[model samples]
Target: MTNPCASEIFKELSKGSRNLTDLTGLGGIDIFPGMLDLFEQSGKFDYKIKNGNIDPRLGGKTDIINGVLVITLSNDYLSKATSLSVSRTIIHETIHTYLHKQLSYYTRTDLNTFELLDKYFKTKYPLKQDYQHATMSHFLLGMAVSLYNWHKNFGPTGGTLGFDYYYKLSFAGLIKDGTSELLDEAEELIPPGSSWSDIDKIIQNEATGNYESKGEKCK
Candidate 1:
């Protein structure tokens, strides 16, 4: 939780209380290995990095086919992506993978539950057609952690901008008001000053119908 990236803004639609520790729980374990446990009881998880012909226009992609979570990242992005950016990409796809699994599970159990989950995510996340922007929120979140770690270890290597060349290249203008929007959305699920553990508890509550909605959506 002490990781500086834990404080990076995920959403900021409102100015009041926010829960900044949502991603900190993820900081403890290597984000990749953590993917295994998420699917341990459910199924298998795997990934690969494609170098040669990845469309230069694309950064990364995630697919869950026949119960396997597969992540594909461009070689160019791999070569240039900072540890934090890489982690961000992994985590972003992880969210998609998790939501997919939960949606499917709920669908089998009760159609209403599946509909609720679908409606919930659609309101929070951009649709698949807007995939880049959809995941851009997570990329910035990861960059916040990376930038924080960079400062902690090496100090502003990028000079005045506080990040650096690679991070700016990957992120740039994709962050306008995104962090606030995400944090504002999360605040409904998490209370101010909550830790990563608290956020997780809320997610569990959500799955069990213990969580209530304040009826807010990202702007």
Candidate 2:
């Protein structure tokens, strides 16, 4: 139950935190894993770069991890995340710190990784192009990541009543995470009861562009 990301705890351990060169350089953790504070709309987490949960100064900065990050995420996160989500986010940001420590440019290529998605969906839209120009695919991927994790955990037993409840609950996060306004508009475009099909379509469009980029485009 220790708040490892707290500055008070950090100051006792390290003399002071250093500025990371970029997001990729951050790695290591001072905070105890499996720890959490009550999640809140106004609440934020702080991590020291050398070791902690989240850097408090990462506010307003999308690509760099030089300063601390105060991640005041949307309320949408509540539905999809359990303690597990926090763990994953912690590891994710940690990787950014580690890589950014040695190099420039935090790893962003994977942020848009849409490999083999087109063949799965098969669409006419340029999902990859849209992904590059707009953050649409990023939203989709983030939603997919959470969904996939949830499914991986409960998907085997046809899911429990509790699991199903959680899935429906997270539906809002699916929309809110990054795809809200876009999802709302797109959901309207889609007919009810075929949401999965529509989601596939978007993936297909994106995958096609991805293959094209490799010069080995899929048919």
Best by lDDT: 1
Instruction: Give the Cα lDDT of each candidate.
Output: 0.36, 0.28
Q: TM-scores of the models, in the given order?
A: 0.37, 0.26
Per-prediction CA RMSD (Å): 16.0, 17.4
| Tens-digit lDDT string for candidate 1 (81-193) | 34334433444444445445545654233343345456545775455423333333333444344433333333323223333222332233232132322343223322346
Stretches of candidate 2 above 4 Å error? 1-66, 70-106, 110-145, 151-158, 161-191, 194-219
* Reference-based lDDT, residue 36, model 2: 14
C-alpha displacement of 182 in model 2, angstroms? 5.4
Candidate 1 lDDT trough over 10 residues, lowest sum:
9-18
Off by over 4 Å in 1: 1-52, 106-117, 120-219
Cα-lDDT of candidate 2:
0.28
